[model samples]
Target: MKALKKIATSLIILALAAVPAFAGQQGESSGILTWLFLGFIGLIVVGQLIPALVMGFGMVKGVLGHSDDHSHKHNA
Candidate 1:
């Protein structure tokens, strides 16, 4: 029973060791996925930042009364 346990443990260790080797074989799909993940993150970051920047600029412009043209345009 002890010998059987030792063999089983050794097999388990070998299997675990092979996990990295299997991961290494995941190739181009993994690289593509990583780049896609980064791009998604960048898009989200930019999406959040751009709106905030625009809102800030709009607030500053509004407070400064920079867009007070309330006159209706005459249609030709």
Candidate 2:
């Protein structure tokens, strides 16, 4: 009985691990969740990636220096 229980447990683990190996073998589309996840990742890439790249380039170019753009006014 103990050996049978150990074999059953090992079979269950093996089956769980093998699940992804046979994934998409059936002719079925990946459905809406995949597209929705991709869309979410796309939005994040657009919102964060572009600005980060631009800011990095600007930093390398020294475009963030605080220059005196306003004239100083003297008051008594």
Candidate 3:
């Protein structure tokens, strides 16, 4: 099952990467709408990256066994 998942993921990534190559040549100037569409896509990408970065930091912190000072304080 894991192997199948990896193969499927690889194929999907390859398909996405090939898109730009299949695109028509941009010979004319792009208007505001084109810029807005690109900007929206950029924002979506950054939104995804933020969560991924947070998860990655958490994984690293877990592996290092780091804890906050508050967790160590106890009340009698």
TM-score of each: 0.43, 0.42, 0.50
Off by over 4 Å in 2: 1-27, 63-76
Instruction: Residues 3-23, candidate 3: write the lDDT tens digits.
Output: 868998999999999999958
Question: Order the candidates by TM-score, highest first — what do you get?
Answer: 3, 1, 2
Q: Model 1, 1-76: lDDT tens per residue?
A: 5986899899999999988887666445557888999999999999999899789878977898866677989889
Query: How much is the lDDT of residue 44 in candidate 2?
Result: 89
Q: Which of the two candidates, 1 or 2, achieves a greater lDDT against the reference?
A: 2
In model 3, where do residues sit more than 4 Å from their true spots? 1-26, 66-76
Clashes of 2: 0
Candidate 2 lDDT at 68 equals 67
Q: What TM-score number comes out for model 1? A: 0.43
Better of 1 and 3 by lDDT: 3
| Distance from true location, Cα of 58 in model 2, Å | 0.8
The order of the candidates by lDDT, greatest first, is 3, 2, 1
Candidate 3 TM-score, true structure as reference: 0.50
lDDT, candidates in the order shown: 0.85, 0.86, 0.89
**Lowest lDDT 10-mer window, candidate 1?**
22-31
- Candidate 2 clashes between residue pairs 3 or more apart in a chain or in different chains: none
- Summarize candidate 2's per-residue lDDT along 1-76 as a digit string, tens digits: 5986899899999999999988858786888999999999999889997899788878966776777667878798
